[model samples]
Target: MIPVQRVPVSDRTQVLLTRWTGRVRDAGGTPKAAREQWIKAQTPRKHVRTALESMTRGAVRCMYCDDSRGTDIDHFQPLENAPLRAFEWSNHLLACSYCNSNAKRSQYPVNGDGVCLLVDPCAEDPADHLRLLLKSGLYDPVDKSARGEETIRVFGLNRPDLVKGRQDAFFRACSNMRDWHRLHQDADPLADRLAQALLDSPFIDVVHAMTRLKPVAEATVVGPATIPALAAWRTAHSLSFRVGQPRVRRSAASTDCIDGVADNALASDARSGQVRTGRRNNDEPVISMQNYGLTWTDITGTPRSSAVAYDESSAQDRKADLVNDGCTNVEIVAVRPGKLPEPRG
Candidate 1:
């Protein structure tokens, strides 16, 4: 599952949520009564529903399986368990019917110490807990913690159909990455279209999987160049918006043009940052896509963003149905990437 960026609800909506929570708090009702009230009050709040859907990753697919359309606003912390948290914005997640109604329901498993065993990708990157094997499409538990295993069981993450979908997504991502690399190397404009295709595709876990499992995907799916090319594209794509309109940043390290945008611009542009004119010499001048030193404020109002060797998306322009549906899951016994919290169990 992808990391969700929770957008602040409108003041009016926030007030509505707060009022609902207040009702449960003041009623001194059983969790059942709170849940009943919640079911009644939640349906009319289309605004809340809209906000939840907008924030979920990858074409609004179920934040759990990433296979089907997300139709339910799931309480990550079940209402039956935490009635007072019923209307909390942070407690909500987008989910598909099968995952919400059938697979998970209200079952929330926790360790004996009462820490949740469920992996909430909205709260943290699932990659840190579970590594999705691109080859067979099964998840590899990262630590001794039961959270990874429990999350998979709760969500039916390894169900045959879902496994097939993830497998399909992986190969599709690889082909698209290859296509993107080719287009990008030649400065082909269609590279942007392909990037969108991958981003918009179902099962975005596959895209993130490519980044997290860099060496494996490189040797098996595409080639050595996939991640670097995608890294450059993502950098350029994100930085494009930062400079007002889409223009490449021309650091001292950069020396070229974007497509054909001119090198010189207003002095204010220079003071602010580079304005276009740094395309690689292939069609533009070759520029390193590495090390933009990205930083951002995490949800807890803490800053943990760091400069890393690699980061995140890619795909083809649907030239000829480059990706066909397929199913798979396998375990790769490899060393975990980083240190995790000590497992409770």
Candidate 2:
């Protein structure tokens, strides 16, 4: 599962959700009743689904498996126990029917502190808790107590079909990385193409794990110790790989970017009072092929926007397909690197 940015919902939608939650609360009914009321409301349901789909880049891939198209709105906290959060936006996640109905039906387990055992992809980094075995395309928990083990079991992440998909992604990513490395010494344009291809590869999480890069995150700053290899590559290539290099005071609560960014562009943590090293921040460059117009926000809240196609012929073929499908614009942007932050002292 990849990290998804929770975009802001419209005021109209927020108001509708609030009204429904208030109704459920006023009735003091069971979660079943709350769900029944929510299901009956056509407008609010549509708005919520749309907002969740947007988080998935219109592909609506399941937040759990990252393989199938998401067909249900999953409650990160089951509405059965957390009834009051029935309509809470943060509690909602896009999920495929198999992961939702077949595997994780009302199975909300908590640890000793009442903290959830499941990994909320939006709230935590799945990579920290999970690792991908490239050969088998199976997910294993990074540690015994890691939440990924439970998440994988609960979500059926290692099911045969999902494993196959991850396997394909892993092979593609490895091939592209090798190609990039081969062209590196030659200063070949194909190397750049290979990098973009890796960025847009399916099962992006696998690609990230193989490359040791973090996915996108809530914050832009990253530390050198987090991604030493990637930092070294960026330095050798003289490429800036960060999203944005804002110099604001860092807070203790912030997390590193999930998507990779260039080194040293992050602000220093005021709590730690250390001047982190300096590196360039290269924002993500996008290559979109959508039926509708591209409308999405970036880490910098900038409007607008790749794959491995370094040659003109292959690039043209992809662009042609987009144009035939009614895509009007074709823009290519740079990508940044990111790594998990070190624990604060």
Candidate 3:
């Protein structure tokens, strides 16, 4: 997920929030009764939602999935779990209904040490722990941070429809950038439309990720057509040097860390057209005996929940045990070194 830039609420709204926060924190009711009441309120409180939507990217999309239009104010810290922050401005987030109610709901997991497991997009960059593989349209942990795995599992980030949405948006964003670059000078209106289309589309992170690709890597993976467009896009975002700005040469360290991991060559499939092309390195199915940053599908074969662990025996032995337990198609995937699950706090 891209880092969220939060804007401040009006002074009047801020006062109202202060008063509301006190009431909610002091309210004595059944479990989350006070929170539900606060959520359903109209006057004064409605301003909170309007203010949040303005902070969202691309047609007010969900901050979590960054796809669907946001329709709910998700409490970053669940209202039930951390009631003190119930009406606190910094504790609320813009979210889609599916992500708020279905994907996450009131489930806020913490490690043994009581550290919150879910990544707070507003407070920290998710890329610090997780990296989205643009080609695979799946997320992998940058290191062995449990927060990344927990966030992915909590959001069901690798579900099929979302992955396909990212995959489709990836190509469409490039095409939009290319079109905008070609017509920018001569056809102002059409160029503006092209740029707006790219901005309004879902999976904006995909566009941002593409623009951050290193020069040589971009040439090898993304076709040459989008190079200039990528440059313009980067300039617009203040990520690249403009005409008057001094050129700042970035080392490999800074360049790669632009999004999450360093920008490098990762493979794309042969089915790709001139838009992008590469021979994929790892595309096989894998299952682990411990949680992995690589997403795992459920028994129905749909991308969904937490990873499963088999016996820590030999690969054949693990496969045999899974088969004996009625998982005939299963294959054992060992957790590589430096990729182990983060120990619970």
The prediction achieving the highest TM-score against the true structure is 1
CA lDDT of each prediction against the hidden true structure:
0.58, 0.55, 0.59
Best by lDDT: 3
* Runs in model 2 lying further than 4 Å from the true structure: 178-201, 213-345
TM-score-superior candidate, 1 or 2 = 1
Q: Give the per-residue Cα lDDT of candidate 2 at 325.
A: 37
lDDT score, candidate 2: 0.55
Clashes of 3: 3
Q: Which ten residues in a row have the lowest lDDT in candidate 1?
A: 325-334
Worst 10 residues of 3 by lDDT: 272-281
Which residue ranges in model 3 land beyond 4 Å of their true spot?
29-33, 185-189, 238-345
Better of 2 and 3 by lDDT: 3
Worst 10-residue lDDT window, candidate 2: 286-295
- Candidate ranking (lDDT, best to worst): 3, 1, 2
Model 1 per-residue lDDT at 38: 80
Q: Model 1, range 73-134, lDDT digits (tens) per residue?
A: 89888978988878776677889999999999999999999999998765566766787877
In the range 1-345, model 3's lDDT, one tens digit per residue, is 766644444333444455555566567633476576576555435666766665565688998998999998888888777775666666778899999999999889999999999987766667777787777788777787899998988988888889998888877877777877777534232454466567667997787678667787887756888787777655443211111112121111111121122223111211222111011113211111121222223244443211222123333442443344343234344442123222221
